[model samples]
Target: MVEIKEKGEFRYIDEGEGDVMVLLHGLFGALSNWEGVIKNFSSGHRVIIPMLPIYTMPLKKAGMDGLADFVERFVETMKLDNMILVGNSLGGHVGLIYTLKNESKVSRLVLTGSSGLFENSMGGSFPKRGSYEYIQERVEYTFYKPETATKELVDEVFETTKSIPKCLRIVAIAKSAQRHNMAKDITNIQIPTLLIWGLNDTITPPLVAHEFHRLIPNSKMRFIDKCCHAPMMEHPEKFNRILENWLENEAHKAA
Candidate 1:
């Protein structure tokens, strides 16, 4: 647990060493969300987990800053170069934005249940299907097993929601719902990219993955069974295997 707040109010956790792998969590999520997958990933890669600035605040309004700029500063401040960016859900959106802006810094990109994508050309507006109830519905769609959406899961997500102040939550939600055409930027990105989706995820849905696979030139898509918005958490073993295999393939290709 390495803490460095030199860059705003963010602390970075460093684990393992080799190729740098930066992990960013989704909305209502902090760095801790990666606790389950980090150990498996750390054996062969340096993992840098950052606590997002927006979520770190208690009652402050989420800023209007674009995801790309935030990532640029975060990477520059950390001095991380030639790294892979892995993001889940909202984190995926951040990773995509960052990669689009700083292509040279990323060796590869992987997104699990990422959110910065849409099926139609309309790139703005908060998800009408974003409320807690809507989130539950979306979760049902993203996970193949309905049992996964148990009361415990609901409570866990509710707790996560409560962790953030209402003001920041509203702002973050609003920013996400609003429009911005990141797809155009992704289309020009030539870096290696991987899109992982939970076949059951209704929030972003598999169609969102299809959109990314369609736009991003060098990209591939994989679906995790019985998982929803977070395959890395719900199905860590499968997630790790796929991630390692992809990394290995990337290494061989680079060599």
Candidate 2:
């Protein structure tokens, strides 16, 4: 069963037991983005998916640093220690920043199609409102298979951008991302890390993942063919298999 908890403006889902695994979603996403993977892993491990307020709260100012600070506070509030951190896109960037500052509290790190290492390939422009075509175009950019941009997904995203407050928040986060660069410090990350990328990801692309693997002293990189930015959603079974194997290996080493 999934239990919802709130602390100030932050909300998260906590489920299952044993070692904890915290999943963080990217910009314009909530904890629901990881529902499938969360359910799959909850049977064996404690899974916590936090809804980052950067996207949901009506804030006058927001930045990567602020988001990382929120994660730090969340960890402290939950009394989590040596837990696993898995994040995608902006969430991945926040996870990296958080792990760097609180290395002793994290046992491992997993990043997929994450941003922050370099400038975005999608340019710095925010999605335009009142244009479904533009919204569809932005959504399609994240996928290798354009057909995967189903009607339901496109409509949901289109509706999301229609809200003026949400649009402003999105723009704030995007600008923050453009200014944030952690390439110089990635090498300083000493914890075991896993870098997963989709071979066809155009947003961050596979090249960024390669760079992350090279920078992090103790890290492994894996790529999924014909997949795009959201591999855990586009190719969930394969993604889960890879994650399960990695977790099993870590367990064996610990024993």
Per-prediction TM-score? 0.80, 0.93
Residue pairs clashing, model 1 = 123-179, 124-178, 124-179, 125-177, 125-178, 125-179, 126-177, 141-200, 142-200, 142-201
Looking at model 1, which ten-residue stretch has the lowest summed lDDT? Answer: 119-128
lDDT of 1 by residue, 1-255 (tens): 434344554477888898899998865456666866778878878888877765443333353244445667778887999998999877787787777667899889998877766522112232232257754653444356766566566555555545435435545644653454477678888889998788877567788889989999999899987676778777888888888888789889989
Best by TM-score: 2
lDDT for every model? Answer: 0.70, 0.84
Clashes of 1: 10
Question: Where does model 1 exceed 4 Å of error?
Answer: 1-8, 56-67, 119-165
How many backbone clashes does every candidate have? 10, 0
- After superposition on all C-alphas, the RMSD of every candidate to the true structure, in Å, is 4.4, 1.9
